[model samples]
Target: MSKEMLNALDALEAEKGVSKEIVIEALEAALVSAYKRHYGQAQNVEVEFNQKKGDIHVYSVKEVTEEVMDSQLEVSLKDALLLNPAYEIGDKIRFEVTPKDFGRIAAQTAKQVILQRVREAERNIIYNEFSQYEKDIMQGIVERQDSRYIYVNLGKIEAVLSKQDQMPNEFYQPHDRIKVYVSRVENTSKGPQVFVSRSHPDLLRRLFEQEVPEVYDGTVEIVSIAREAGDRSKVAVRSNDPNVDPVGTCVGPKGSRVQAIVNELKGENMDIVEWDEDPAIFIANSLNPAEAVDVIFDLDNPKACTVVVPDYQLSLAIGKRGQNARLAAKLTGFKIDIKSETDMEEFYAKLEEGAYIDAADEVETLDEAVSESDLTADEYENVAIEAAEDEATAAEEVAEANEATADQTEE
Candidate 1:
């Protein structure tokens, strides 16, 4: 029995990651409590267990006195003398008060104590394990679902995916393993409470980290992520190293890396674009795949932008249900008013009809000579857009040449 108890402690220390000494100390305390409950609290009890002998010793301490007022707490000096001739009146005596049924009580108490300690140790282990992963990504299986939450088993503990944290129109099934962003790790009376999310922008960031080696190595950096989870996500990337192409590396050889991430996200579309410091250039990149003929910013109203696209590309720019336009608006923090060449011409014609009074002498009026051309206002705006792109290309080329020259000089 003693050997078994020692082995149990060893197992708990190894499995639950609790210290063996802690378990033993808890066992000693529990045994003391059990002895007092079973016998009496006034009796000074001591318990000793030997693994080799499989023996448990329980003794009650008493003070040796001339007269024994309480039999349980004091021993007569005559009786102490019979047990040990050296006994004096003031000497304390430890009488053998070993109870036969103590083995049964100890076994029950030990079981309870070990179980309680194991749970506490496991809770701590789970808390520490998930605490490090907070604000990061994790993968787990869908274990069960409650009224407004889904429980995911992430090896050591279960994480709660609340309804509000889930993407609208997304569903999970039993045994389905999915990627989740660990938003919060909280300690509770029950155990560690892990809040997970699938709709967060960071989920896209983590996916890029996993897919792109350059991102992990600090060669490629994800500047920003805007995600409408389960539908579309836009990521802006920058290259720290001149030799690396951030967008190309994230795309991978033959599009394998990005494809893998898309599969994980269950067919959510991703737009990986180069990050630019200039707001106009960044806004233009953010609205890619839809050719923006012009992106006119309102200086007085910073949140407003006038976007013109070719008549044919108008529907594509707006997307099905205006999703593309809406997403672009959200990403750029702009109230985008999209117009085709025909719509733009009609709008300017109305403006020309109204006599315009110049608020500032510096403000340039639309040249009637250029406006006479059937090409429309959008065509004129397209010229300005091209000029901006040309300047940006020239700047990038110069920067790259400088970096190349520096590298050559170093070599």
Candidate 2:
């Protein structure tokens, strides 16, 4: 049994990568409990194992004292001196108490400990391996599905695809292979849990990296992505090289690269646009298939803007149910209020009308004040001149503001 136990330890270390010393230490502790339980001995005892011989020993430990208060825990100095002359007061001594049937208990304890260690070692290995893949992409096979999650086999372990992470338009079947983004990895009491996603915006970015050589090699950088999974997605890319066009590189020759990604996503539409440093230009580019006539920013809020498109392209810029405008806002990190050219014209017209009404009211108020004051002719004339000057200044300011708006729109 001793030789067999040593061989088992060697096999465990070689096969499972579990340290033999760790198993031996655990086995020794378990044997101590087994000794006390089986023999009904409540004495202070310890267990030791011989690494070379694979022999297990149990010993009763006692404190050497002048007067032994508890026989189970202490030994008298006179009795200890008989066994060993060097025994002194306050010293600890061990007496071998190996039982006749201890080998059987030790064998059982060793088996249980080895099995537990093997399981623990396997869990650690798996956790360490999968933790590195967090926030990355991997191809997995669909094994099965339930109401809550879809199980995907990723080489050694199974990953979970939750309901929210699954694409609505795609139906997963058993044994179907798919690419997934590793959103999170957690080490639980049971084992390692990997949460994967098909709808994450980063998944689109990774797909671009895989399909576009310029993106992978860092010549073209993906600025941002806005995706409505299973429907449509927009990607903004910028190029470091002056000669390379970021948009054309991502689109590929004859749109083959983007088409491959779209097919992989189950007919999801992709709009790849060039990223510009200017927020206005980038926002304009983000609204593809619909050209922006002007981008007017909100002075009070830097992240808010109004994108004015052609009157005919209002529906296209807003998309079906405002999806296009919503995605452009997300990609540009701006709060977008899309307007048509006609809308802007109507807005300006209302402003001018309001100003004119205010001027007329001021004139009426001046006339009322003059009639009530009974001022001399010269004083009244001076008051009239001041009012005219104020009106002229207000009109000039309004015109200048209008001119600035037009100049910005043209640029």
Candidate 3:
């Protein structure tokens, strides 16, 4: 390697984060192999890389041993002293064995080694760089696409956007810039693989965080998010500060803050609702625009609830195909069974009177009826015997009454 090559290394180090020291070490190793290959011998070898002069030197090493059993690998002290008086028995000596055409060989080796080193360094750098961005948001340009994946150019690296993670109705085109959620980063044999997503629920959360300062700073907290991708999404937010309106803060003046995010998501509908500590109220809030008349929890199963709305809101509460109710269920972590005023009138009337009747009670009554029915013959015989005994007692009483009447007439 020459000074020009060393300058390139320095520039590579600065630009690609590839350490010059690592490159130099790899170059030295490559040259060591080159020296042994050209020599066709296994003599102990050493390579020193001079950083200042940008020079590499190879040496054949021999130990100054008392007995020289292997002359190629060791030297006697008397022979070592002939070359240098300070030579010791255990000291090693170096003889410069650098080939005459070593520079040419090294030049080719350096080219290959530099390319390999830069590739590895770039991979490591990308891995370290993108790993920090996991679960975060990023904006990238759509570079290309295939049936299975779309490649997005993320400045230094291209991230894969799988078809599965894409928005349902969003159409992609070349050079279209879109915001994406960094779903994962992996270190593969080829390099670092970054997978981005447009359908993840966190994508909405991160978009809001980026647009709204209150959410990023913790004044407003995003309680939960449920997204249907390119169609509709619901975000439940709670304000730590009583003065801050979480939903209003996210909506911004004239609906600008949310609209910007909506535009980024290709006009996806967003419902930012205020989160309530009371799940009943929260579930009601989650079904926005369509007023919820009542929300009743299934105490037997805490994760389920039945929501009641006005007759007019039945279709609105359920959306075109239950999209609103589905997103509400996801956002509230409850199984929502939405009913209209006219739909389940009996159910609401029970709630209006402040009472609940278990359907299980009706089942128990039916069981009792089944047990009373189909009686045995022995049971019927016992009933007939009791009736005959009652009739005989009545006959005895009538005979005594007649006797009393006769005695009164004689007197």
The per-residue C-alpha lDDT of model 1 at residue 263 equals 88
lDDT of 2: 0.92
Summarize candidate 3's per-residue lDDT along 75-141 as a digit string, tens digits: 8999999999999989999989888888998889899998998889889988999999999999899
Model 1 C-alpha lDDT per residue in residues 343-372, reported as the tens digit of each score: 876765554333222211112323443456
Candidate 3, 349: how far from true, in Å? 9.4
lDDT (CA) for every model shown? 0.80, 0.92, 0.86
TM-score of each: 0.66, 0.97, 0.74
> How displaced is residue 130 in candidate 1, in Å?
3.4
Clash count per candidate: 0, 0, 0
RMSD of each: 13.5, 1.4, 13.9
Least accurate 10 contiguous residues by lDDT in model 3: 352-361
290 in model 1: Cα distance from truth in Å? 2.2
Candidate that would win on TM-score: 2
Ranking of all candidate structures by their lDDT, best first: 2, 3, 1
